[model samples]
Target: MNPINKVSQARVMSPILSGLIYAFVIMFAGTLFTSLILLLTSANESNLPAFSYINHIISLLVGGWVAGKKSGTKGWYYGGMLGCIYTLIIFMIAFLSFDAGLNGRSFLLLCVSLLSAGIGGIFGVNSRK
Candidate 1:
């Protein structure tokens, strides 16, 4: 509430920024892994999607966990916020790029993303430094 306290808090790096960074990190790692697997394996096209989805969720989890750990406070809040931001961006891109239509299912996906991030945040907070 006080100006001094606010200033002190300002000195702290935003968890949102760190969370986004972690998300990118996870995304990159996922891409690399996927590429490697695709190159090495002769799996069916249908199976690739299953692997993709699993890695995608894992990446999301790791991103949220890193965000929570970096924040060192209000893990769920930060992680959920990160999820909301991430999902909104994705939604926007889909809407703009391909003129994709929104539906109830899309909304539900957002909810799932938020919940996943929040759960990962809890784990991050609980993990030992």
Candidate 2:
């Protein structure tokens, strides 16, 4: 095959890249949705954290679906990876932007988000076409 064909074939086989892109898309969409919701509700920064969890959940579901759609039968792994990457990026952003006080609740939320994303990914992967 020509090198261009080989590159195209490689791209087709790259679930990781697809998953990462899905993650970014979902996260961006989630952030936009959450911002709009917050603006509509006039939610202050203090209450934003509580509402943000809902956004995370939404993002996870969407991300899982995207990953599953991209990966076919291997969607579970791809989705999970996407979730992990998304969480990492979000956490870093939070750490840099706000004073997310290290507390029990914060820790719990982190754990829950990770697990929820993983489960969502599995479901997405196994879901019917």
Candidate 3:
């Protein structure tokens, strides 16, 4: 087969799917790290909430960056879409597992996630490979 034909035949995953996978992985790692910290040290339990929020933000930002870089155009749009999809997935999981309901805090999280991902996407598009 020709080189060009071979390249075209390769399967390419969507950027959004790629970003979501990265986001989930990052979240899992952060959760594990946070749990380890809480278990190993006498850290104040009160800070757990703050740490969780930070972790989510970081995860979304990185995921958005990956999506933006992969798409190589319309970074903000791709990142925002990724954030929206991520939030919906999380909401469904929370509802199913914890019986969590949408509320003010959830709204805030959605907004923050969108903003964080958008910013990361902008940066990613402008970044040099």
Candidate 4:
């Protein structure tokens, strides 16, 4: 099947897609945040690392909540999936752009992202009713 046709025929609504949309929105927000940070501090002196980490968590929180709402079941699973996907995208970009290597702290934060998102997911599911 033609990819375009396939997409048109496929289910348009689902937890996964909702999470992706959220992630995209969050990425755009991150870009804007990055611009502001750059303006505020010199590159070498900038707290980009810490700020990005915080931003990522924020994104996961919002995205996870959205995912849970759409999922209707297994909210935490969907949220964790969303966080993992988002993290992978971020890591891939860093690896490609700067040949960055993952370290222990990076792994720890990845787990934290999943946990934070999962918590948000639970909140989302419970808050609805």
Question: Would you give me the overall lDDT of model 3?
Answer: 0.88
Which stretches of candidate 1 lie above 4 Å from their native place? 1-12, 103-105
Each model's lDDT comes to: 0.75, 0.66, 0.88, 0.77
After superposition on all C-alphas, the RMSD of every candidate to the true structure, in Å, is 4.8, 4.4, 2.4, 6.7
lDDT of 2 by residue, 21-121 (tens): 66567667878877887788867778776666776776676666656665667666666676677767766776789956566765666665566566666
Ten consecutive residues with minimal summed lDDT in candidate 3? 2-11
Judged by lDDT relative to the true structure, which candidate is superior, 2 or 3?
3
lDDT of 1 by residue, 45-95 (tens): 677656755665676677678778877778898789888887787689879
lDDT of 4 by residue, 25-53 (tens): 88679968787878876765356777777
Ranking by TM-score: 3, 4, 1, 2
Candidate 3 or 1, higher TM-score: 3
User: Residue 50 of model 2: what lDDT?
Assistant: 69
TM-score, cand. 1: 0.74
Best by TM-score: 3
Top of the candidates by lDDT: 3
- TM-score, every prediction: 0.74, 0.63, 0.89, 0.77
Local accuracy of candidate 3 as per-residue lDDT tens digits, 7-92: 44443888789889999999999999999999999988898988888988999999998888888888899899988999999899
* lDDT preference between candidates 1 and 2, better one: 1
Off by over 4 Å in 4: 1-11, 40-44
